[model samples]
Target: MHLHCYRWTGRGADRARESERRPPHPAFPASPLPPMRTCDWLLKPRTRIDASPATVAEAVAWLTRRYRSAAESFLHPDGEARIGLDLRLHLAEEHLAGGVDVQWGIWLRGGDFITAAVICCSPNRHAPHPCPAAS
Candidate 1:
């Protein structure tokens, strides 16, 4: 299952932009922004399919491409876009970490579309030795 998240910027929206340029002062109060609406989190292509390795690889590629495009977009003109930050694949899930399941995080943003912070949990853990039964 894909977990989707999103945010929108109407006219006079600059909170996302300001946050990046300057670190918030310790005494600065938080802005009370309104909650995102249901209609805002929609995507054009709504086809469902198996999320196999191939699909994931494609998604990764898409994220990578978007990153470059967005970075360029932000750099041009008056130096702005609704997209403040697109942190795709925030953390790498290394099997080196000791655990039964691998865990990771993602972050992204897209207008009128769901930017999912997708996490994958592996059923199998890394083992130095093969199962005794197999041996």
Candidate 2:
């Protein structure tokens, strides 16, 4: 589970437990995440696999690999590609707090294909999650 640390990030429970020696994902939010009891959430993948790294640097690298392709897809040869922020963070091990829905993503613009993103949202106390639209 790509745990942000202690809690699940996208990695499964067993996986996180297996690597107890390693300090969780090492990127947990300082305060505390909103009370997100159930893992019953929705997932939107831009591509087949989702490799959301824990840090911004890693995410950059992940995007770097696709730069060439992105360049080719731009509507214009001189078109520039952009990287949109898609960070999902929660405070460390503490009682979850507010009900702010988090939908993180790594957007890409330009190239042969338009920019695409992967968004993941969890349910909160107020309303059902994976709820209405994750499109």
Candidate 3:
């Protein structure tokens, strides 16, 4: 199984800043800095809003709330954002024997609409292990 990250940067340049600064997520240790990489999606000049948990459903809500275009029409009513974890495929394999760790991010375009989604797997010291491309 493969994971895919998706973002919708509508009618503009990409606008995701790779921050060397960490925002205090428990998953990261105090000493180890977050790896730097281009965000899964970058929609420029669009408004961005911050949310808690940053779930897929939130992304869907964003798109539906702001845009009436065909692109924003497919948001699931459940608002479950797609979970494209590279490890989901190996869940029954060796990796599961020891358990695994994962990280995910959702960037919204126009503040309410999601423009990009990113999911990084283990050993992401360099960059996030990208999933399949989003439409």
Question: How many residue pairs clash in all the candidates, one count each?
Answer: 0, 9, 9
> On residues 1-135, what C-alpha lDDT tens digit does candidate 2 reach at each position?
121111222212222332232222232222122112222222212222345455434444444444444444344443242332222222211122233322322223321123222222344443343422333
lDDT per residue, candidate 3, 1-135, as tens digits? 222233343322222222422323332222122223323121211122122224433433433333334334434422333432223233322332232222222333443333333332232233443322221
Total clashes, candidate 3? 9
Runs of candidate 1 with Cα error greater than 4 angstroms are: 2-54, 75-87, 90-135
Q: What is the C-alpha lDDT of each candidate?
A: 0.27, 0.29, 0.30
Model 1: per-residue lDDT, tens digit, 8-115? 223234334443322233222232221222121121111211122233444444444444444443323233233223332322122112222212112223322212
Pairs with steric clashes in candidate 1: none
Of 1 and 3, the candidate ahead on lDDT is: 3
By summed lDDT, which 10 consecutive residues of candidate 2 come out lowest?
A: 3-12
Root-mean-square deviation (CA) per prediction: 14.5, 15.6, 13.3
Write down the TM-score of every candidate: 0.27, 0.31, 0.21
